[model samples]
Target: DQQVKQNSPSLSVQEGRISILNCDYTNSMFDYFLWYKKYPAEGPTFLISISSIKDKNEDGRFTVFLNKSAKHLSLHIVPSQPGDSAVYFCARETSGSRLTFGEGTQLTVNP
Candidate 1:
């Protein structure tokens, strides 16, 4: 019962380009959407979050877009840098604060 899925296992982008990570979910009851970035040997760090009521949220070079009807969401990193390379996970939070995460997508930003 994998409610969330990341269709692409990895993504590679040249530095200074845009990096787009996509995710899809089967559960419509989700209340919040979040993206986390994890580096090797490090715990996942909260990158950005979006409420179900909003379609898009932006913070600095990162932006998250949610499409309720499509059950899809995407995280966009503009002017991607080498340091942005990491395993990115997309998660959905249910009513009780339980979160379901998709298989992470490893993003590599090459200089």
Candidate 2:
């Protein structure tokens, strides 16, 4: 069974608006959460990450919030720019080494 899932296949946000990407997981053993952004023909780049001990982590315009009780997580991008358009993947880390990723969500930031 798929342990992680991204319900929305795509998201569209206007430039300078807030973009919210959602993810859900069924595995309780996950210890960390991460978000990755991928561009055409390039590898996914690490965006933000959160530990299970914390509910939120933020870096500049990127923030990741974890809700262990709800088995959910979200990545928020404030003031999203056109350059931010990319496919975003939500992943859970287990055993500190293995990662389970959700189906990516393509985010389009319109200028």
TM-scores for every predicted model? 0.95, 0.95
Clashing pairs in 2: none
**Model 1, span 1-111: residue lDDT tens:** 538899999999999999999999985776788899999999999999999899999999999999889989999999999999999999888757877888999999999
The residue pairs found clashing in candidate 1 are: none
lDDT of 2 by residue, 3-102 (tens): 8899999999999999999999996776788899999999999999999899999999998999999999999999899999999999887775788889
Alpha carbon lDDT of residue 103, candidate 1?
92
lDDT of candidate 2 at residue 29, scale 0 to 100: 76
Query: What number of backbone clashes does candidate 2 have, counting pairs of residues 3 or more apart or in separate chains?
Result: 0
User: Where does the lowest 10-residue lDDT sum fall in candidate 2?
Assistant: 91-100
Write down the lDDT of every candidate, Cα atoms only.
0.93, 0.92
Candidate 1 overall Cα lDDT vs. reference? 0.93
lDDT of 2: 0.92
